[model samples]
Target chain A: MLTYPKTELNKVKRGTKRAVYDVEQINHILDAGFIGFIGCNYNGKTITLPMAYGRIDNKVYLHGSLKNRMLLALIAAKEASMTVMHLDGLVLARSGLHHSVNYRSATLFASVRKVEDPEEKKTALKCVVDHMIPDRWETLRPMNTKELNATLVLEMEIQSASAKIRDEGVVDEKSDLELPIWAGIVPLKQVAKLPVRDALLPKQLKTPKHVVTYYKKNKT
Target chain B: MLTYPKTELNKVKRGTKRAVYDVEQINHILDAGFIGFIGCNYNGKTITLPMAYGRIDNKVYLHGSLKNRMLLALIAAKEASMTVMHLDGLVLARSGLHHSVNYRSATLFASVRKVEDPEEKKTALKCVVDHMIPDRWETLRPMNTKELNATLVLEMEIQSASAKIRDEGVVDEKSDLELPIWAGIVPLKQVAKLPVRDALLPKQLKTPKHVVTYYKKNKT
Candidate 1:
């Protein structure tokens, strides 16, 4: 069911091979992340560019200036690939040699197309804004024609996607078991520190109820 | 300059044209990452793969198992393209519309070649391990011939590269500065927690100084 070369990947590169993949994991990582690394060949040159993104209905939407050339390379090509990853936690094994990461990430494979119509541009913008903050688009003022004209959009239908992960505790080689060292997962996580408010606002400024709501989410 | 079209990436897209790249940032990002992602079209089919790697003086050394078709594909063709990235921080905007990231990442352009001799393999391993843990090679046991036979090491010298960054704090976007909402960076970080001990017989295990040392190193 997995297309990645498991045996070849595992047998040769022991460090990267330890990563695991499953569909449920793919959704969770994407849902939680706001950035993706977009890679494409530009004018016969290769590039991996970082960008903020949103996913819906099995497709991903990305935007930039209309003048950007990578869009042309992608629009004219048969395929392009993008990846997003989160460094979950550091794996601290009994032996320092065996230490690894507990990471969550996804790669997307797709055929690309450009979105030229202004109506679609507006929709795409709202999709992204809403993805970052639920119900945000509904409250904000809509974009003007000038604002819409300045943006560029590309659609990548996720043709095939997969997630690679290492969330379990550390695995020790048989020879290292008796060594008197610590071993296991020392869970690493991205935590929201106490909110720092913009200084210009009065002391009464507060976090939105919805925004403050994430406190109960997995602190890990 | 920036290669990607501006309209495609959604809410998490750049807040300004500044987030796009010129040629220099692309090369820097490629030069800095610890590893990268590789995907290929195989006889009308495609595969996405991830591997641990190290960059030395602009040359990328990719080590894995001899069984990997990726290594075979690259070495036979004498060229390949891969994407590498390093995530810095997450941007949490006040209006969700303006939220972004503070990131420093790179992806390199390179070609693959086999590292055939024992000495060369040892040198490449040194770079890989040291890339993750500086001053680490001197502390460990060097690989034996049996271990070398079980591994595959491919070298890919970089040809070109690029970088893009999102480093600004929450952009109040002028017009929204008056909104009475908390706005600031949550400061995302990847940290190593305290290590957990092995399940077996050690009654008095303690973490080496590096356990706390490494965690202190991640200032992110």
Candidate 2:
């Protein structure tokens, strides 16, 4: 076993590419992401949507109008699979044949239940807010009864899951290495700029330092 | 009734937030993502994983080692639902109550299936390569039979879907306008850096500008 056995996905034989299995590495990838692509089937059509979500203690918490048909169907099905991702960079191989992407991603398989409990729902909301900005939940107003009733929270109990990744760059076959082609990685990054408050906000309101530091993410 | 009716979800009522409805816009969001988050249920233990994927026309293509249990489950399910996402930026509101994120996201319903045809799988790979780097596909070498066989191709048909977004900063109720708060949108972006070739790649290889100038996605 390697020093990082938990992070390896395929241990048997990786005929082509090696998969990452480290949970720490995976968590790093998740925190770096701001959104996730939601995939599911309805009336026989496969539809994909990008949505906002949060990760807490290994489980995923998502909220939208309870009326979201896709969320309804998946929760109704009681079972769904979601793919969350962080695109690290683009892989450039010597030959177009070997071209690929350098990224870190994950897939979750779990049973979902619509969160109905008032306290649990509040906890879930706090998880999301804290995920967006660490410890921001305590600094903001707690969910009033009205706001809680207005939204539906769904909890996906993550069961069996796996993460696959293609990092580094093209490893041309021994003979193909001689080909004259640029081969390497083109990095990708997500950056958050300075906070912009709402136009209608009270005149006395000012930006918080955490809000400013929360935006430390930027392209290198 | 609103100028941006498509932005609102259909299930939302008059008092709810305004959401976009154009499915085409939703598809555009799908194309913008580099990775995905998968939620699934297996053996009752819920788990989530991130993955790399490509959007070609109305289909989403995701591949990995066929031996992967999670992917096998998707093919086995034949039809399931998932969410694909790209987070554009964070929206900072003046009032903590009105705080929200500025994001472009889409949610979809889909039936998952494994791509069987060899030519089709090859094409999917090409599409994936192109999706990640645009025109760079035409510049690369063709995939040989072995490379094609090593990868597992799963295709999801993009049928009925919805794209929703909140692009601006804080939207406080009219009365909240008098509150003194800094409010505006903090822009977010996905950027690419100069390409780096592999250490062993031929020295004659030169970087192509197209590899660097493809469409930039706004991801979380």
Q: For this target, which candidate reaches the highest lDDT against the unseen true structure?
A: 2
lDDT of 2 by residue, B1-220 (tens): 2122332222333223644456567666777765555544445433345556778766888788768666777787675445555566665543334656766655544568899899999888777776776776666666777777877999978545554576655566565455444446767777766556678865665566675455233233
lDDT of 2 by residue, A1-220 (tens): 2223432222323333555545566566667664555555544444455555678756788877757776787787786656666667877775545656666676555578899999999888777766766656665545678778877888877654556677676667677766565567877776765555655555566666666667663523
- Report the CAPRI category for model 1: acceptable
The lDDT values for all models are: 0.61, 0.62
TM-score of each: 0.76, 0.74
RMSD, candidate 2, Å:
5.6
TM-score of each model's chain B: 0.74, 0.82
Candidate 2 docks with a DockQ of 0.40
What tens-digit string does per-residue lDDT give for candidate 1 at B108-213?
5566678989889888877776665455555444466876877788898865544456666676568767755556654554555555554563777655565556
